[model samples]
Target: MQNTAFTTAWRKGVIARYLTVAGATVDLTGCGDHTYYRCTGCGHGTHGVSVIERVARERAQGHAETCRALPRPTH
Candidate 1:
């Protein structure tokens, strides 16, 4: 038997998310007027995007489409 921790964007204040090719998650989170994406697989993410929602979404989708890193263990 094993246990793993599962979380959600809404619960964590994330605005959106995408699933990577390896089943990992790319979370889109925002603070105040700034938005960004962070990958749970290989720690790939965005920075200094100002308040551009489209750019954040675009980068998140692009990374999700190509990222092959498997989801890291939740232990």
Candidate 2:
């Protein structure tokens, strides 16, 4: 059995975009080089983030909830 939820980069991208639109902070880090994004009035790595689609489609929705509950930027 394989987990197909959020397993696709394209899906991740879409969710990322939604987060951006929702005014959530986004950060993509690299080994030596790093990139940082911020929301208008919020800081990075504060609150958790989620995908409505994932929650609705996942078999173990509770797992999805936990993933979204992870520490993340609040912006």
Candidate 3:
């Protein structure tokens, strides 16, 4: 399936973000010439940067499917 969940331009270094059903986000960040994804809800994501863009994007999308973590409110 095609992933259209990524939203852009909301934060620096954030290439895209996948907002979960519970309002948590899976963020795709660009690090130098590499890329990595991190989840704000369950805190489950790739441990290190992946040079392959497709792999990283797919991983982020898949994680969003099962993650039901609600967003943490800012103080």
Candidate 4:
């Protein structure tokens, strides 16, 4: 797996976010004021207030269990 970073940027009048993890690029979708992380690898995602916070929370909550892009064992 590769070291990844989650970032967000403003595109137009909305927030655009993406996550680069283990060589896969996951595009985030925004709904209302919440952002969702959709894994390009496994097609799994969860909603958060921010992309960075979402990814961090997902990882901390053991997203690797279902995330194909991040297959490393979580402890």
Candidate 5:
């Protein structure tokens, strides 16, 4: 399947730290106290108080890998 629009949104960072791999959507969002990752396919996510953004990014990537949903490499 082609997800050109999804990839474009990810590349542009239109929704902050959000990514869609395969049919799963990973969204990172937070308020003043905490940040969280919400995955649609997995039906669960992680969050922390004042956690670094990279941690969340890594978690999302890990989930993608486990789900075998990583995006295909572009030429």
Candidate 6:
């Protein structure tokens, strides 16, 4: 599990990416419970799923919320 601060930051990043036209990629690598997000177009890291989950929990309790879901594949 990730710390509160880290998870919060991760959630913000994911939300931003997901809502943007720039797009972002979310990946679950190996056996890790955490999810990683990367920008496929510019090759930049976005955030992780653990972070998102943390944010979701916080929001359910009346906290504010915040992805960069990467762009589609190119042939």
Task: Supply the TM-score for candidate 1.
Answer: 0.75
Candidate achieving the largest lDDT: 1
- Model 6 alpha-carbon drift over 4 Å, by segment: 1-17, 21-33, 46-73
lDDT of 3 by residue, 1-75 (tens): 332244323567888787776667898887544888888888887767465667777888888887898655544
Segments of candidate 1 deviating more than 4 angstroms: 1-11, 31-33, 47-51
- Screening candidate 5 with a backbone cut-off below 3 angstroms (N, C-alpha, C), the clashing residue pairs are none
Cα TM-score of candidate 2: 0.18
Question: For candidate 2, lDDT tens digit of each residue in 1-75?
Answer: 332223324323222322232323233221112222222223433133333433323312222223332223223
Clashes of 6: 11
* Residue-level lDDT for 75 in candidate 6: 48
In TM-score terms, candidate 6 sits at 0.27
lDDT (Cα, 0-100) at 12 in candidate 1: 75
TM-score of each: 0.75, 0.18, 0.73, 0.34, 0.51, 0.27
Candidate 3 achieves a global lDDT of 0.73
lDDT of 6: 0.34
Candidate with better TM-score, 3 vs 5? 3
Candidate 4 ranges with C-alpha deviation above 4 Å: 1-21, 47-75
lDDT of 6 by residue, 1-75 (tens): 422323323434343223223333332222223434444434444244444544433322221111333345554
Candidate 1: clashing residue pairs, number: 0
Tell me which of candidates 1 and 6 scores higher on TM-score.
1
Q: Model 4, residue 39: what's the lDDT?
A: 52
In the order shown, the candidates' Cα RMSDs to the true structure are 3.9, 13.4, 5.4, 9.0, 7.1, 13.0
What is the C-alpha lDDT profile of model 5 across 20-59, one tens digit per residue?
5455566667633355665655555773444456776777
Evaluate model 4: give its TM-score.
Answer: 0.34
